[model samples]
Target: MPLYYYYFGVLNATLLFRTARWRPPLLSRHAARGCGHAPSYGKMAARALVQYVVLRGDLRREPLSWPLGALVAQACHAALAVTHAHYQHPDTAAYLDQGGSMRTVVLEAPDESALTTLAETLQQNSIDHKMWIEQPENIATCIVLRPYPKEEVHHHLKKFKLLK
Candidate 1:
């Protein structure tokens, strides 16, 4: 009667009540297999897949001042393009399978140079990503990485901050 088992039982009971379907036993699959301990909630959360989108902050600032809607469109374009390009990739497939639970982290790069440098670094590392260069104007506005395990790409992105 560990605390996690109690919480797990409560969660299973709630699921059963809501879905009206048979649920598995209170012991987790790992525990049932004789593992000494089940993964902690924090560990489970760390396993989640995520996508990272870096948009240029300068686009919305003075000098090159693009409209807010336009910046949003750039992010959308980059995200969709990368997802479509890597749709067949295993990580992308698994991430998409999460449906409503899918996670995306949107960060801000100071300007074109930072965005391009990041893209180049990713390229050198063989990381999969797409850099969206807006047509007609041919400006590189944003970059999106295919869904990846956070541990695999977080170091490269730690310098950037979440878009405000």
Candidate 2:
């Protein structure tokens, strides 16, 4: 009933019909004149149908990591700062996520360069994971780690008489 069925029937006839074999075989010749041999009409039609069906409803779009340059920049900045702090600490190492956020990699590096290297390592890993980086500040500073912890943040605020 489908158009494909008709193509398949014609293909079967060309391949198996007794009279067609005896005839000039123009259809077969046309199908085989080039490309070494022509593929079966049925197969070609089926392939085309499959391609059409598979592509249906599919809309190509840019991948998320296309804007990674922004993330890279943020990661670099945070990494630099974290590395600075981490350099002061003899124990804990610092790292930036591929998404360009900082986190403490405890029991890790002993200095700034090591922490920066760790951040770089995380950036590379983020590239491998195909994630886009975003700033936590966009949501709120609560999410961003200032150069100091809450207590330190408060201590600095006290200088401005902002902290009670």
* Per-prediction TM-score: 0.73, 0.20
> Model 2: clashing residue pairs?
none
Q: How much lDDT does each candidate structure score?
A: 0.80, 0.28
User: Residue-wise lDDT of candidate 2 within 25-115, one digit each (tens)?
Assistant: 3334533544233334444333221000001010112332324344334444544454454433311111111112323221212223433
Residue by residue across 66-98, what tens digits does model 1's lDDT show? 999998998898888899998766566556655
Candidate 2 local distance difference test against the native? 0.28
